[model samples]
Target: MSLLLLVDDPARPDVVGLRSLSDDGTLLDSSEVPTDALPAVARERADRPRWVWDDTARRYPPLLAAGVRVERCHDLRLCHAILRRSVYTQSSALAQAPPGPWDGPRDPAPVEGSLFDDVGPAAVADPLEELQLQLAAVAGSDEPGRLRLLLAAESTGALIAAEMHHGGMPWSVETHDALLTDLLGPRRKGGRPAKLEALADEVRTALGQPALNLDSQPDLLRGLRSAGCDVESTRTWEIKALEHPVRDPLLAYKKLSRLLSANGWAWMEAWVHDGRFRPEYVPGGVVTGRWATSGGGALQLPASIRGAVRADPGWKLVVADAAQLEPRVLAAMSGDGAMAAAGRQADLYQGVVDAGIVETRSEAKYAMLGAIYGATTGPSAVLMPRLTTAYPRAVALVEAAARAGERGDVVSTWLGRTSPRPDAAWQAELAAASAEGAGADDVRAARRRGRDWGRFTRNFVVQGTAAEWALCWMAALRRRLLAVDGRPHLVFFLHDEVMVHSPAAVAESVAVAVHESAVEAGRLLFGETPVDFALDVVVADSYDQAK
Candidate 1:
């Protein structure tokens, strides 16, 4: 007897609609509610209804602001993306239907200082019809249970992304400013940092080009070559290998420059406000199911400024991340007993050594990573045989996926997310290379492209599945945290790590919730199969301290 409540706005700051449905997509009731009364109406039915909305970020924010929170939702946009690409639902009517307005690119979710603000909401016109279409598609899938779980987890991720943005990550402006001043010297009104300018001076002098602009790559490269440096590129790795006076200071200058440009004073001013950092997150933006941030560097928070992620007074930050996520996912998906056993310990690499797979932990790690990622050179290739012999099932799984990729076939994640088919240009290359009079160069080019695709597929299966596991982990954690006695809210989520902003009194409970949710995630994904997904949880005053 689940209730499906379809929500849509008829006009901005005015009329909104709420249509209720029974379990089988049958319309049970319909009502028009004013925007101002939405919170009260939503709160009354929040406990029993599954809120169906076009977009969570757009619809849920105002409800959250008005002190109303719904327990579950079916975000049509997020779930539509899942079903569209899912292999299990490829033959469904929803998959074969003509593209509609829903196929348009999503406007990036709003952040505090975003230029692209969300327009006032208007009626979607057919929220009930869209939900029914989605239901039919889910029913048509071969693995309905699996696809349902995937959709649920994905929608939960959407909700969490919005909620985390609304709550914001606790930040300390004073600490952030102090650290910036100490490293780069005082903030400049219309110029570069003091320390950065000095390093730039050394880089130019060493290259023997007094007026060289370090910011311009071509100018800097030409200067280096003219001064007897055999560098082909100005990239950091290439620069590091060169034996020249400009190497050290140039590297220092680049590091400091990135820090100054990326997260310096201006960044703080734009992103951090009211003692919190609010960034707009785009869930499932990456083809591999990873999240992409629209602004504020949420995914790439530099380690130098982690101390600014301080908890509020009388509160603590519980930070935790999965240990060796991809490899563990590989073992579970492949059902490799040896590989799974090797992950029994906290450090999977060390466990491989203990299982006699390699002589050193480093070798074990290199070999396993090489196996899944299709590496064929360096230490990876040197140690590949030992890894393959030790864990044939795991190696064979990726090998099969690679072979499928070489044949231009599709591959699916552990759930149902499918790898996109080769594009028109790529297929043309393959066809032209197979034609009767094709030249050696054409054949070689096609082979190279095929191998590249193979490598992509080999890694895609593992990485994408790991992302699904992460969503599940976060979903379970969210539920447990909400159910706990004291209020503890999720503040930040990277792919594998999460930070909870909770009162110090509930910090221990939050840690327990973290461990329990991880266990629940493993159960939900792999069932009783005994592959461990270990997490390192710490309670501290700041993110850096927790680490």
Candidate 2:
């Protein structure tokens, strides 16, 4: 049995229209509950009925606040986004339905306030109708099972996102401040850190410019050139090549500047509270289904600052990262037995070297990246023929996707998340270049655009599917952790890595769950493929120790 939670306008937070739904979408029973009592109702049905709703982020937070947790949910907004663009359902009648308010992206999450504030609900205007349409689309798809799995994984991600927010990532401001102080000196008023200022002074002295502003790119470039160093930009890579007095100092300055700007004292005040780091996660935010963070730099946790990510007292942080996720996904997706065999080892790149695919580990990495990313020049291109000969299926799969992209055709991942079609402006430019009597410049421009899109789609198929694999991995881990005895829950997730905060006693159990989740994610997405998604799981007292 499942419950269809027809949420009312959030402004009237007290009201909710609930419908009991059978597995076949049949209405079994219906009732109403004040938003406050809804948690009691949810607790009554905990982990039993799948809660159907407009959006999980909007609805689940309130329930979680009242100490209620749902077992499962079907998020209509997320499903709509998938079904609308899926190639598997493009020809379905559900896709042909006239567009309505449900077609637009949901309004942003509400701000913190009283439930009785009456700010109006952000609920979808027609969730029941949207649910029916999504069901029809899935039922009519050629690969219904794949789409179903994708939706299930996506919805579970929504639940995880909300729960992770409610239970924020454990952070130690003292640890972070100490690390910052050790490396950057004590905080100063309205200016750069002491070490950064020292480095800037060194940069100026090295360039023989007493008053040049190191903060300005143009000023730095002019200063470097005036100092007799030939340089186009002040980028680290560009400056690293020049053998001059300013090289080392300038590079050091840039590194320190990044830390100051990204995770400085101001960042600490804004993102951290009550010894926790709360970042707003936007699930399905990226076109390829990867989560995008709205704040707190959750996706860009610098290694230098990771010491701040300490576990609670009597707890441990079990960190796990997939060794070579994307390449293994490519192997599984393309059914490349050779590549899969290479992935069967702990280090896929080393495994490739062992199999004689390439002479060196570096060569193996570059060649495979070249194949998936459509690199047609330089060392990657030099190594292409070898990869094509060695892993023909994998190379061919990406090449076919690239060719389709060049022709402005859409491509999809294994579970059917399709690449968006080229926009109208691009199509017009392509058409004008191909029209009768086009100029060489026009043709060249069109060709460049085509190749660019080709590269995008070339990587899109693998990256998008890799993101799907990650979602499945996290979703499965969430369920497994829930079934555990103690306080073990996922605290942070970054692409192929996840951190679970657990009691010290259950840290080993959490590590086992992490490994099993990786295996389960692979099976869910690729069935019984030979490709192995190996994870490096580390249980430690602090995040930095996980390395």
Best by TM-score: 1
- Count of clashes, each model: 0, 4
* Model 2 lDDT tens row, 213-250: 98888888899999999888877899899999888988
Model 1 agreement with the true structure over 1-547: per-residue lDDT tens digits: 4765646554554878777787667888888878789899877863477788888878888988888777788888778777877889889877887666455455554333221222334434366777788888899888888888888888889889889988999999999998888888899999888988899899888987889988998998899899998888989999899898899999999888899899999899999999999998877777778887888899898888899999999999999989998999999999999999999999999999998878998898899899889998999999988888988999999999998888788898988888877888999999999999999999999999999899989988999899899999999999999877668999998888989999999899999999888888888888886789999999999998977
**Pairs with backbone N, CA or C atoms under 3 Å apart (clashes), candidate 2:** 9-121, 10-121, 11-120, 11-121
- Report how far residue 183 has shifted in candidate 2, in Å: 1.3
lDDT of predicted model 1? 0.85
> RMSD for each model, in Å, please?
3.3, 4.0
Q: Report the backbone clash tally of model 2.
A: 4
Assess every candidate by TM-score.
0.95, 0.94
